[model samples]
Target: MTPIERKLRIFVVEDEALVAMLMEDILLDLGHEVSAIASRLHQACEIAQAGAFDLAILDVNLDGKPSYPIAKTLRERGIPFAFATGYGGMGLEQPFTDVPTLAKPYVSEDVQRLIMGLMPSIP
Candidate 1:
């Protein structure tokens, strides 16, 4: 018998349009659905609070504003997420040190691997 794979509904929070688009493409190629995208801190916060997603990929900064508020909201909702940043994991503050991070300029395999690791039920 084989296990069935479930597609994940992912929320993306990124300020840069190009980066966001790239992430969307990567996720799609990885067989995941992007539930929503938020390019600003406030919008991201709102989406984090209201959206139903299996997981999220959040940028550490959104147009010079930190994204901790969105992270907090996701945490409150019990949704697991990873940080994507140009500065790698170092871009995250001390409080977020334990979260997984995908460095900037990542490849599709990196994104796929990270997502698979985060959500083991997905194949």
Candidate 2:
């Protein structure tokens, strides 16, 4: 018998509205629900502080602002997250270098693979 996959509640922080929408669609297709989406650093930080999520996909840069604050909040909350950046992992600072990252223009499989690595039971 096939094991039932867990449906994770995910938080997404992307400054680009279209990118966020695409990610939402992709997450839904992957059988996960997007608990919340924030496009600004302050708003994302607020959501990170107040919301509960299994995981988060954070854009390293939100407009002209950095997403490190939100990442910090998630870290304190014990939530796992991966960075999504157009500039690749090189864009991240030393402190965040060890975190997983997804390069921009990622496909559904890319996201699935990353999340599966983070949560083995996801697939």
Candidate 3:
């Protein structure tokens, strides 16, 4: 299957309820499954540790705290992920500066691009 045709299990970490729902909706509309949603740093970290999904989109700030720890966990587990932020990838620190990013207020096309970025060989 091609990247557009593959169904990914996506984990979403966003503090804002509406944004989380939006991400989930976009993922669903793209024919992917939302494996889980985390709205806080601690919860998101736990989910990242479990690493249950094929890919993830992480909000940069969760309840005023950075989601870097969750990003670290995802990296350690080797699960592909992208940062979702209004500020874009400039907020990222060392070792994660180059990870894919999905800007805020996303639509289906942005989500599709994110999917392709994370899994270029998704077949």
**For residues 1-123, what per-residue lDDT tens digits would candidate 3 score against the true structure?**
234657889999999999998888888878899999999998888888876689888999898998889989988888888999999788788888998888877788888877977886332
TM-score per model over all chains: 0.91, 0.92, 0.92
Clashes of each: 0, 0, 0
Q: Write the per-residue lDDT of candidate 1 for residues 1-123, one digit (tens) a residue.
A: 112167889999998898999999988877789999999988888889989889999999888888998888887788888999889886578678888999888988888877877885322
State residue 60's C-alpha deviation in candidate 3, in Å.
Answer: 0.4
lDDT of 3: 0.85
Q: CA shift at 60, candidate 1, in angstroms?
A: 0.4
Candidates arranged by lDDT, highest first: 2, 3, 1
lDDT of each: 0.85, 0.87, 0.85
lDDT (C-alpha) at residue 13 in model 1:
93
Q: After superposition, how far is residue 93 of candidate 1 from its true place, in Å?
A: 1.2
Residue-level lDDT for 15 in candidate 2: 90
- Candidate of highest lDDT: 2
